[model samples]
Target: MTLTEEFDQSLLPGELILLESAKLFGATNISPNAKQWEYTRKFPIDELRQAIQRGFGSIELPQIFGGPGFSFGTKMRIAEELSKFDLAFTFALIQHHNALVRVAELSPSDHSRELIASMLTGDLIGCTAMSEPEAGSDFSSLKTVAKKVAGGWILNGKKGWITNATDANVCLTYAQTDTSLGSKGIACFVVLGDKEGFIRQAGYELHGAHAAGVGGYGLVDYFVPDALVLYAPGLAFKTALQGVNRARIHVTAMNAGMLESSLSIATQYGENRRAFGKSILEFQGLAWSLANVATSLEAMRSLAYRGARQIMRGEDALDSAAIAKKFGNEQTLSGVAACMQAMGANGLRAEYPLARHLAAAKLLSYTDGTVEMMNERISGAVKKRYVL
Candidate 1:
């Protein structure tokens, strides 16, 4: 049976519909089905083109903007299932909307229409142009600059670790308005991918997300018109983290999906193979390890759904969302490892899903917000109650 068929029978009907829709959209460009993201490292433009043709690019925009206006719940469901298939592909799709949120929140209505139209028609792709090589976690240390000029602005300095690099149609970028204001001096800019002097530099041949084919940009006097600005000077960085938190939660759900995929594959292998004169599941130790995976996965789903519901209700789930993200990523990794061990050496083989699941957990856990950052956020919440 196809995975979608299995999904329909296993997931709730509503969830099944969402997954089927995403699948039909070809929103995922991850290759090898059960293995790794092959196209990204090499820039699988052909498959990506097919995905765009399938409407993968416009999944979340408002209908008037050529998007589906899907609820956060629906998005979370799609992200989780897509991550089960391919994390890099899921990451690529989410970056576009993450970039769009700035436009949605601040762009002039006309600019909004233009950008949203491009997004819907697959004429525009986007990348987040934050994160210099030196300013990993300490965003305050970011040094890219944007200087105002007549009728426009001049962007200078390098943007390191860009996911889509120079190939994207646009970049949701942040730059320093004035060094005197430091991190708070940061202003957001919407720069076109084809802008002059905006060069994508070498690097980002990564240890993971290989299909991402990541790189960076060296912005040398790239002039972006004031017409292209998404947020007013210094506004985006102030609110930048809210978007990051949302992405973190989405990434957590993706990790949960990957782990879920691996666990099912592992369990099937365990049941089929004989170990010590019986299936590995027959061993009490192995059985209990499998039980841990089940319990942890259930917990992950509960927390993720709670976070999604809380967000939909406009509740403050920042701390709780981080907790869910951290919990799901951590537990999923532990479970994948356990399942791998239960499968013996065969689990380490590329054909098995657990290996890729472990890699995916590592990627998501570190990418959106580090687990340590999540802990600090949680600690702040605790401290706010005078319990730190």
Candidate 2:
């Protein structure tokens, strides 16, 4: 049996159906053109719009808001299935879905009613901007400033490493209303991309994963009316923290998916390819290497689901999420590389997804949170959780 079939038996029947649907969606819509999108550095806007029709645009939005409102565990499963095909494209979809949830749940009813509708229909794409040129992991150090003015606030700053930046028309932007108050001074605003002062900057040329549309933009005196504020000072930072656990778990699932894909490819090649007058799988060395990756992949899957379940149950998941992300990041990077090494020269070929998966594994290590940041979180809780 395939790795997914063996590993996913723990899922509920309904969740399995959704996962199968996501698998089919990725195979039909994303897998075929993922290489081309990477080669040409295109964002696959049309395909993402098609994904919205398939119910991928609003995975976490409430049913009242016209979304599937699936549990957090189910959403992570779907994310794993999609990421098996392509991490960059899957990440873009996740970002868009997250933005939809943020707006529907946080924005004022009268202000977001129409905006949410357009987003669901894919007429308007969305993204969140938190990291700036000078601040990423240390978000409190962000220099983006928002000054209060008549009728609205004027924002000025540049956001970098944002997903869907090139095509997004609606942005959830965070700016400091007062630097002295640090994180407490941060505020979130709905900044329309078409506004006069919103500047779309050129995208970054990464080594791979270009379908993410990772880019940056500048907000030059961008005016956001009082009605557009999602979180005023003293509340925005806490709101952002509330979502970090979910984000970390989602990224862990993606890492597991990528590792699964790479291992499957390498295993298939080892079983079929012949060397020294026998199948390469006959070689004890190569076989054990692949076996190690398989074991770690299962462990990563378990950690991902554990964190997801905690969030679903409304339990404290900060430590679980950090541990899962930290383990997944370290394992996936090494695991994908081990899979590639098992394939020899064939692994480097563009025809296989191994190369792309490897690059994506490295890129994902920094997403959601970095390994160092995860370590800090886990280390802080070690004495409290372990001593008892």
For each candidate, what is the lDDT? 0.71, 0.89
| Candidate 1 lDDT | 0.71
What's the TM-score of every candidate structure?
A: 0.89, 0.96
**Residue-level lDDT tens digits of model 1 in 1-388:** 6332332353455545656767655433453642435423555445554555555554555665566555666667777877777676667666765665455554456866787667555567778877887776777678888899999899988877777663676787888888888777888888776768878775466655654546778788989888777767567676777767677667767877877777888889989999579887898888889899988887787777777767767787788888898898789879889989988999988766567667767777777678888889888888998963
lDDT accuracy of residue 148 in candidate 2: 99
Error of 2 at 248 (Å): 0.7
- After superposition, the stretches of candidate 2 with alpha carbons farther than 4 Å from their true spots are 1-16, 107-110, 386-388
Local distance difference test, candidate 2: 0.89
Q: Lowest-lDDT window of 10 residues in candidate 2?
A: 2-11
